[model samples]
Target: MTVDPELLIHRDADDLAFSVAARMITAITDAQSTGGVAEVVLTGGRVAARIYRAVAESPARVEVDWQRVEFWWGDERFLPPGNPERNETQARDALLAHVDVDPARVHPMPADTGQSAEAAADAYATELAATISALNDEKRRAVPAFDVLMLGVGPDGHVASLFPGYPQLAVTDVSAVAVHDSPKPPPTRVSLTLPALDRSREVWFVVSGDDKADAVATALAEGDVPAARPKGRNRTLWLLDEAAASKLT
Candidate 1:
C-alpha cells in the first residue's frame, strides 16, 4: 500500500538527529508491543551517524528492548569487516555498541573476503531470505517487512547506492545486488534493491545540509530520481533539517 510522503523539517541537524532518535525508539517499542521483533534497516551517512549517537545517548533508550530489535543495513561499502568506512562499523561505534543488542541479530552486508561483489551480494541475499523464512509463515518475499527502513539521499539523488540512471535501479528479481563502479568512492558496494527497500512499514529519509536540498526537492516532486522510487507500505517520511528542506516549495 503506497502512501503519500510526509515532510518533517527540523530547526537544524542537531535537532533533527535527536528528534529522529526519539521517533526510532518509539517506533521500535510500538513494533515490539505487537508481539513481534522490530526489524529495522539502517542507512549510512554523516546525518545518520549523528542520529545513531543521539539514539545511544537518549535518556529514553531503555524504552526499547534492543535485543529484540533486528538491525540490518540498506547498503554497505565492500571493504573488509571493521573498516572505519563500513556502515556496520560506524553504526556499531555510534549506537549498537552502546546498546545491549544481540550481536546475532545485527546483520551487516558481507565484507570483501576474496569473493566477487556479486558473490557477496548473493550471500547476503541468502542470509536475508533465511532470516525471513524463519520468522514468517507466508513465503511472499525474500526480505522481511521491516518495521522502519531508514535511508540517506545522496547528492546525486541516490539512495542505498542505487544511483540515478544506474542499471541496478531497474533490478527487481533480487532482494540485494552488487554495485560496481559506483559514482561515489570505493567503487564497489552491496545494496538492497528497491523491492527489498519497499518491503517496509515505514521508510524514513534522513537528510541534512544544503547540498542535499536540490535532491530532496527533486525526490519529493516525483522527479525521475532513484530516491523517488521506494515507498513504504504504511508511511513514507522525509525527515530533513532546514538546509535540506530549503529547496522545497
Candidate 2:
C-alpha cells in the first residue's frame, strides 16, 4: 500500500505543536504494539521544535519505549556541537534533553569529523550504511521504512537540506550528503538524500508564516513529479497556518 502524507493544519503554532505531539505518541504506541521498536526521522525548525516541546510535555511521551525508539536527524547543520544553528542542538534543548533515549541511538551526524565537507559527507554516508545495517529487516537491508518523518518547509520550497537551484537537490544515490551555500544561513549542513526520504511511511511538511505561502502553494499544486519542485518528489503533506495557506484556491 502507498503511504499518503496528511496535512492537519491548526489555528496557530501552539495548536499545531499539540496536535503533532498527540499524533506522534499515538503513532509510536500503535507501531510498538505491532513491533518492538519505532524509528523516527526528525527535522529542525521553529515548527518542528514546537512539536518536540509538546512531546516533551505530554504524559504519553514518557510511556513510549524511549529506549526502543532510535532517533535520527532528517538533516543537520554541519556546525560544531552546541552550535546554536545545529539541528541536533535545537532538538536537544527542545526535547531530547528531557527524554531518556539511548545516547548511542540518537544518530546526530558528527560534525567534528576532521575533514573537509566532501570527506565529512563520505563519512556520514558510511555511518548511515552501518546504522541501517544494524536495523535492517528481512526485505530491506539497512533502514526499514521509518514510522514517521517530521519536516520543516523552507521559504524557498526546500525540505531537509535540499536547497533550490542546487545540484544536491537532484541527488538520488547516497542517502546523506553535505550541503554548502544553503540560501538560509549557516550554509553548511548534512541532509538525507531523496532515496533516504523514501524510507518514511508518512511525511509531514509543518509550515507557518505568511512569507511561505507562495512556496507552500507551489509545492502542493505543482504535483509530486520531481521536475516541478524539490518537495514534489516524495509523499508530502503541506500543513500550513492561515497565513501560509491563504493563497491556495
Candidate 3:
C-alpha cells in the first residue's frame, strides 16, 4: 500500500533537527518495545549531522537501548573507510561513537578500497541479502523492514546518490547500484536503489535551508524527480524547516 507523505514544518534548522532527533528516539523505542531490533538507514548532509549531534546530546537518548539499533547508510562517498568525506565517518563522529550500538550491526556501504564502484555495490547488495537471510523467518524479504529510513534531499531533488534522469533510477532488480559521473562531487559512489529504499516501514526526508525549498516543493508536488519515488510502507514524512517548506503551496 502506498502511504501519503506527511509534511512537518519547523521554525528553523535547529528546531527541525531537534524535532527529528526526538521523533527518532521515540520511533526506535517503539520498535524495540516489540522485542525486535530497530533498523535505521542514515543519510549524510549538514542538516543530518546536526540531527545526529542532537540525537547524541538529547537528554532522552537513554530511552532506548542503543545496542539494539542497527545502523545502515543510504549512500556514501566512495572514499577510503576513514576519510572525513565518507558518510560512515561523519555518522560515527557525530552520533554512533557516542552511543552503545553493537559494532556487529553497523553496516556501512563499501568504500573505495581499490574496488570498482560496481563491485562495491555488488558487495553491499550481498551483505544486505546475507543479513536478511540470517533472520531465517517466514516473512522473508530482500531487505529488512527498516523502522526508519532517513534521507536528505539535495537542491537538485536527488535522494541518496540518485540524481534526476540518471540511469540508476531505472534499476529495480538490484538492492544497490553503482553511480558514476554524478552531478555532485566525488562522482564515483554506491547507493541503495529505489527498491531497497522503499522497503522501509517509515521514510523520513529531513531537509532544511532555503536552498532546498524549490526541490522540496517539487518533490511534494510529485514532480519528475528522484526524491518523489521512494515511499514508506507505513509512513512517509517530509520533515523540513520553514526555509525548506517555504515554496510549498
TM-score for each predicted model, relative to the true structure = 0.97, 0.89, 0.96
Q: Which candidate, 1 or 3, has the higher lDDT?
A: 1
Q: Which regions of candidate 1 are displaced past 4 Å? A: 138-143
| Residue 78 Cα positional deviation in candidate 2, in Å, after optimal superposition | 1.2
Candidate 1 per-residue lDDT over residues 93-166, each given as its tens digit:
99999999998999999999899999989999999988877777643454468989999999889999899888
Q: Model 2 Cα displacement at 129 (Å)? A: 1.9
* lDDT at residue 156 of model 1 (Cα atoms): 81
- Whichever of 1 and 2 has more lDDT, that candidate is 1
Which ranges in model 3 have alpha carbons more than 4 Å from their true place?
A: 136-143
Q: After superposition, how far is residue 127 of candidate 3 from its true place, in Å?
A: 0.7
Model 3, residue 217: C-alpha shift (Å): 0.8
On lDDT, the candidate that comes out on top is 1
Local distance difference test, each candidate:
0.93, 0.74, 0.91
Each candidate: how many clashes? 0, 1, 0
Candidate 2 to truth, TM:
0.89
Clashing pairs in 1: none
